[model samples]
Target: MSNPKPLRKAVLPVAGLGTRFLPATKAMPKEMLPVVDRPLIQYAIDEAREAGIEEFCLITGRGKDSLIDYFDIAYELEDTLRERHKLDCLKALEPSFIEAGSLIAVRQQEPLGLGHAIWCARAFIGDDPFAILLPDDIVQAASGKGCLKQLADAYHETGGSVVAVTEVPREQTNRYGILDVGKDDGRLVEVKGLVEKPKPEDAPSNLSIIGRYVLTPEVMPYLSKLEKGAGGEVQLTDAMAKTIGEVPFHGLRYEGTRYDCGNKLGFLEAQVAFALERPDLADGVKTFLKKYIDKV
Candidate 1:
């Protein structure tokens, strides 16, 4: 068989209504929420860029113009910053802007599901194996290489679809797509099967998939059927499950901390954790956190 094509592009599904964040998300996309100094979406894009992804396809929905605008050059803002000699401010915006023609935005137009959102990007993805990063799932790698980069390195070695997974408790198996094991090393598991949100008793293993995935383009046809599975929506997990044995699939246990910014508590925790990582803010945040904990 021909060698696997080099992974170049990535798809980010940012079309969710952000209902979990409620009023804060009323006028803004949840992915735009600030995590310390950067928006949640920016972190995902940075991770993809770190993985050598050159083009980005953002699957957007209504009222997501802010997300598109965020990656665009702010001519007026730059002018003001330059005029005031605010070099630092201008430098901060550099990474947020994508190349002139590398970014593509496709509209989802409905709240179908993750599978549907990904399927919308089929035209842009063409035939390349692509990476997918959920903005809400911010994964911080202790090794300095971003989570997607870690997965990309694994993909190059395995030459098939690779997904980032973590071992969740057995009782929590119902909350995620659990993997069935075929063979295992300490860091990677050969995926024999995948079940979407299976019951604790039915779960093949507690190795649950996170938001990071490097998928083969062959899965697009399965998603195109729009078949609603668990939770009565087009589940991406369902589509991935069909690819077993057809390709080499493996689950990567990345060394990272994942913050689920989709939920209230998780969002708060991420804010504090990310803040504590910043040198300028670390001391103050830690002091406040300790006092608050003692009072409670």
Candidate 2:
């Protein structure tokens, strides 16, 4: 039998200045921030792996070398683990999971916008469907599905654009891409149109866009024409909006809880919630939570 066409690549936009994080992000790429023990980007990569993405195009800038290094082989550390007979540690650091050749880091050069960052990986993406996973948004599913995978499954069947979405407070709809709903089952909602950060009262629907996206290559030209809006940057939401009626744009209500790690409060919440879920750290994290849960 002929092999099915592979979903060959994915673009991860990690070049953001992460200014929302202030002092801490001033020294680190927010993507490297840990949720429990794994870096935020690791979870993003893990999600891509779950969806069978073979190539990872990282749109990065200066001071982001640590992210690339973390996914590379640490010979000395592995050798030490081997010498000390720390089998579990050595296995945990296995190089196989890190696809060195499949990793391509291109310079974003400027923090123009999410669309610009995705454009930075144009060569890696080429002319095909590819997934975009934002590391700043850490998605967790008790149902064992990364939000992006849900979109991918939808894309696989429909061969069109799909985005992760959920209902946000109507007052805060301006902070997200608001979906104009057409038809709805329980899981997938047909998008009649899209709006980028519409004023609460102006919003057509309460559905807020999440970080997961499965887009076709045709969206690249639209992204290239993106004009700055909202934050003086070329918003991906604007680019996605351009595809409204032409593309089969739909919103997948992902069976997961998403955390915005770009903010301090959200990051802390993800760290605490993830720690409480880990078998090794749950007891300690729960105890610490009670100590500070009320007062802090």
User: Could you tally the backbone clashes for each prediction?
Assistant: 0, 0
- lDDT for each residue of candidate 1 in 139-225, tens digit (9 for 90 to 100): 977988889999998998888999999999999999998999988988989998999999999999999999999999989999999
TM-scores for all predictions: 0.98, 0.93
For residues 1-296, write the lDDT of model 2, one tens digit per residue.
12323466889988888888778889999898778778899889988888878888888999998888888888898888889999998776653357659898999998898888987777788887899998989888769877777777888766678889999999999788899999999788998888888999899999998888888877888877758877898888888878877767889988988989888889988998888888999999888878887787
TM-score of candidate 2 to 2 decimals: 0.93
Name the lDDT of candidate 2: 0.84
RMSD of each: 1.1, 2.5
Candidate 1 stretches with Cα past 4 Å from truth are: none
Q: How close is candidate 1 to the true structure, as a TM-score?
A: 0.98
Ten contiguous residues minimizing lDDT sum, candidate 2? 1-10
What pairs collide in candidate 2? none
